[model samples]
Target chain A: MTEGVVVVGLNHRTAPVEARERLAVPPDGLEDAVRAVLALEGVREAVVVATCNRVELYAAGAEAESLAGELRRHMHARGGSGVTLYEHRGEAAVQHAFRVCASLDSLVVGEPQILGQVKEAVAAARSAGALRGRLGRVMARAFQTAKRVRTETGIAEGQVSVASVAVDLARGIFGDLMGRKVLVVGAGKMALGAARTLARAGASLLIANRSFDRAEALAREYGATAHPLTDLGMLLQHVDVAVCSTGASGYLLTRHDVATVMKARRGRGLFLIDIAVPRNVEPAAGDLDSVFLYNVDDLERAVAEGGRGRSVATIEAERVIAEELSAFRAEELAQRSAGPTIVALRRRFQEVAAAELERSLSGKLRHLPEGDRAAVEAMLDALTNKLLHAPTVALKTAAANPDGDDVMRAARSLFALDAEPADPRGEVTRMRVQGEMTAKAKAGNGR
Target chain B: MLVGFLAAAALLYLIATVLMLTYLVGVASTLPSRRAATVSLGAAMVAHVTHDILRWVTLGRGPFAGIHEGLSTLALLVAGVAFALRLLGRRLETLGVFVAPLTLLMLLASQGVDAQPAAPLSGALLGVHVGSTILGTAAFTVAFALAAAYLVQEREVRQKRLRGMFQRLPPLEVLDVASFRSIALGLPALTLGLVTGLSAGLQEVGRGIPIVSWRHYLALGVWAVFAAVLALRLLAGWRGHRAAIGTIVGYASAVMVLVGYFVRGARL
Candidate 1:
């Protein structure tokens, strides 16, 4: 779990929306809210991601339990009073952040807005001076992982609603509905939604209905041309897509009427979306060449199929997240162990280089001039840095692996920088090196 | 050196076809396999073009004077056109799945045929005659591939089976329009090809060479089928499934004409 990271929050799954809305902090109040949370005892750094569906607080401290407790108490005092608070410690907390940024933890799994919300949260915390070190890196990496999930999988590929499916179907039939004619056969609520979506896609909207006044009302609202139901045939001949969401008892568009329109248009494809309970378009009309007629049942079936596809893509995204998480952990471990080993190895090389130089100066090179002696000492220090360069880099890479302890131990033994207490003579070498460093600092000051 | 280039091109086309199939069948990831297949196919086309040029230089004539050379030229044209469309910003790389296999089969078939060059052409006119005919056939080949994709995609949408390869295929409208445009381009080229071909045959007859009646009839029949497909679309508003089927039939007829030439002993 990497020791001290923690998350305490309540979400759609843990508590009802009523409880969630109570604790939901708006964007303007987010910085102040996160600052208050940071003021709590044991919470070192805090980022509060407050969205409509979730309110999660991510914090890091010396102890996870104390951090979670402080954050949870502060949260309860400020409006989390009745809701159940959930907590995840250390590595699980990081994983939760990853999932939230990836949108896998959203109320609607794979919805894209959560990523932006988390980015905003991180920004708020950073401006509040609450983001530092591991938590900041984790948030940045979380964004990259989320981007990978988006591009590498089809998690956001299909439409899940009947109204949106109508748009998808039309786009499938006539790509880039720009300036294409769209005829909404009824002014029902569902038809209004379908028409609004199509109009946004740049289609020229036409609303036709049995009640000309109702059609005109919807047409005025949507910036579309209004037509009486009697003109449906004329509209069908020119319109590329027809959304049928009427309250008709029998078929609003039968096989014969569509076939006649298809001929009148001279073989151009016709996409008819019949989102009605009684099924407005005749099911057999879909069989005609270039005619795609989808009723409410078909659209719902497509939604269900899209859900299945989303699930599969979600599984693929999770695998990518898991792989990235493991990589992060290994690298984090390596980073933690590598820093001290690098310092000790460089110190050891310097110590040995200094000791040998002293022996040479006293025993054989005693007659060398003062200037020549200083040159030899400077060259020896440079050689020590150059000699330890490769091992220092390698130890950092080798040591944080799940099975990296052997490499760390081997490095310690090879350099005589043991975890065990050093002998009296070894202590003498370390003190001599420290004193030499202090003298070099004074010598630079004198120059 | 010529054989080496041909073998490499064949292998690359095989790789691209296999990679595309894996992606379409959902056995592989999307971007990697698609990118690999595109690279492999692009390399194959380069090799195929190199081999065609080398043969042309060695023989001191056009490449399409025999079945092997003619089919090789056709394969290059099909892959080159489809690849060119992708480079031009048309999102039709998925069509490479069909293009690669067809190109590979043609290249392999070309290798299988006897490598016998025809008598050197008398003039530029005959070269134009042969080149236009092959060019028209290549456009038809591309149209045929689009038609096949359209039919598969149409079946999926019509049957409400929107999973697997259904998601991978281009929209039905895209396939339909691309296939139509190919034919719209093909018909004029085929018309010129027929005219030049007839003129050349007439010259051959004047030189006391026996005229092949069945070859002329097969060429005319392929032209008629393609012509009908276009006429039906323009006049009767026929598109989608029927238009796709019609284009496929036209391609089949065109292939039969090629078979007529191939069976007549590499006189293409």
Candidate 2:
């Protein structure tokens, strides 16, 4: 089930966002896209994962590598023409699926949205009747792999954006943002961004701007209060965090202003976020007691640091995905290799039991009643099954390891079963041919 | 027998300290996990209190009597206060990095001093002076440890390069408040100790001792440092880094008083 899995598409890394946007299929268009891929000859099972950052088609079939070209062509025709595409086949393909589902392949390596996006794609493909057999099992196992990665690793530990990092810094200072008061100095984009994150963290926000109208407008959105810029002093004394992004030319709040407010708050910690262009808050204000002030550059540096921290976890996540892929492949190979061998061994033993029963019934048990003879034949068949059970169990159990394939071949040859299952699956072909020859032999003998 | 318990406690404290360092390093952490370190520290504290009680009973005197007893008692007080704070659910247990080793050091320092027991503290004023002074210094010791934590956490926040050991600390606000509270507790105790000491000095003037000995002056110094910390925190906005540094300085004066007693009592 893990083998012959293929993914052919372009992501943010392989193609630009413009290219990705061109190739992206809308949510409603997903089933149609997957059905189109399934219509191709060598694509037995198919799914289309199209998000803002990537567009991919996953397929499983007998000739999966061949389907990669067709999937690429199909994607190009669906508006990915100028975009470069990448393809992974077989074991590499299975690993690519795991990485994608785990979000190691996303532009933001540990972002969580990719997992749900791919899950939707799988659902869409299932709806289109294109998800069955190997591809379906592979995706189900991929979800399991993704779940393990999320729980077992620290890949998603830190906030990566400026606004979210502001929240993280506040929590580091205050432990919890619940009921914490945040003062936004100006109604600019950066200030609004920071205010939104803080308000979402359960903080009560107060928007203060020179234009009272802008403050009131932003305040209405957060269900918070609006105050004029002149009220910054009284407001600063009350709030735990003050985001200063005003467009004032000089220091709107000087070191002395912050120091006075700190004294008013009785030295309770105040976090000042100066994300303005001309830097509204004075740089020296950070030196005051219980005042933690961070400017735009400092916040950006912290954001970058968070990115570097996740890279270490990214390596750990990669190791996890590698382990899951190998485990998945081993289990799949065990079923593929041991399954047919077990069947052939059981057939050979049952045939021998049947021939002996026929000879005995005709020559020695000629005087027995019909019912008694039928019980004897049932007992012989049960003996053959019991005899072959141990070897069948051993062969399948051994198939879970690398050397299990060799043991499977040895078990086949020991039973005089024709050919090996590993040689492009010649065991099935040989079994079919042998069955046909056996039918001809029975006809010629006319027993 | 007291030495036996002390030695066992010192050994346990050493093991607990080493285990804590390893736990911080992310190694040697298994089923006998962080809980083992906490248990060992608890046992060490138990043995420490037992050693103090045995000596107190043997001599029929409080631990405030002499330099050895005073240092040993101070060590126990610091550990007890820190452990209590942790049990109160403040995320400040990392202060044990300073408390544990300092307890061990003080125990060894106490043992190095003369062993002959000083007579028990008599006269209510003198007893109060000794008791409150030692208690006040113990509180200062806690403030000192918290100040160190505040400095580290403050640096991490100020420099904006928060990596390992940064997240391990309690938030800057928590550390600042905790350090300030320790100072708050110490200030009153030291003030009471000084007032009683002054009353005694005025009543018994120049009786083989000057009214203002070096310890009296040092106690005043510690008092003044904490006084400035509190007044500035309330009046001049001195609370985070500067306040932590001030608390550390105040605690240093308290340490000087202990060293003064330890050295002077040994010579006597």
Best by TM-score: 1
Q: What is the lDDT for A375 in model 2?
A: 96
Q: Which stretches of candidate 1 lie over 4 Å from their true place?
A: A1-159, A308-447, B64-68, B86-91, B109-121, B206-209, B259-264
Candidate 1 structure quality by residue, lDDT tens digits, B1-268? 9889989998998998898778777798568777787788899989988888988899653575654676788888888876775555424666777777778766766665676633334456555666777788788888998899898888878888666667777789889998999898888888887887776677777798856467677888889988999998888777888999999888887766555544564454
Model 2 ranges off by over 4 Å = A1-161, A188-190, A245-267, A276-284, A307-447, B21-33, B64-67, B88-90, B112-126, B201-204, B208-212, B264-268
Docking level for model 2: acceptable
Q: Which ten residues in a row have the lowest lDDT in candidate 1 chain A?
A: A438-447
Candidate 2 C-alpha error for residue A51, in Å? 22
lDDT of 2 by residue, B30-123 (tens): 5475667778888889999999898888976577766577678877877786567546642566677667777776777677677553322346
Per DockQ, the best of the predicted structures is 1
Candidate 1 lDDT at A384 equals: 86
| lDDT string, candidate 2, A334-426, tens digits | 666677677778766766777788888898888899999999988998898888889988987898886885887688678777644333556
Which residue pairs show collisions in model 1?
A266-B237, A267-B237, A334-A400
Clash pairs of candidate 2?
Answer: none
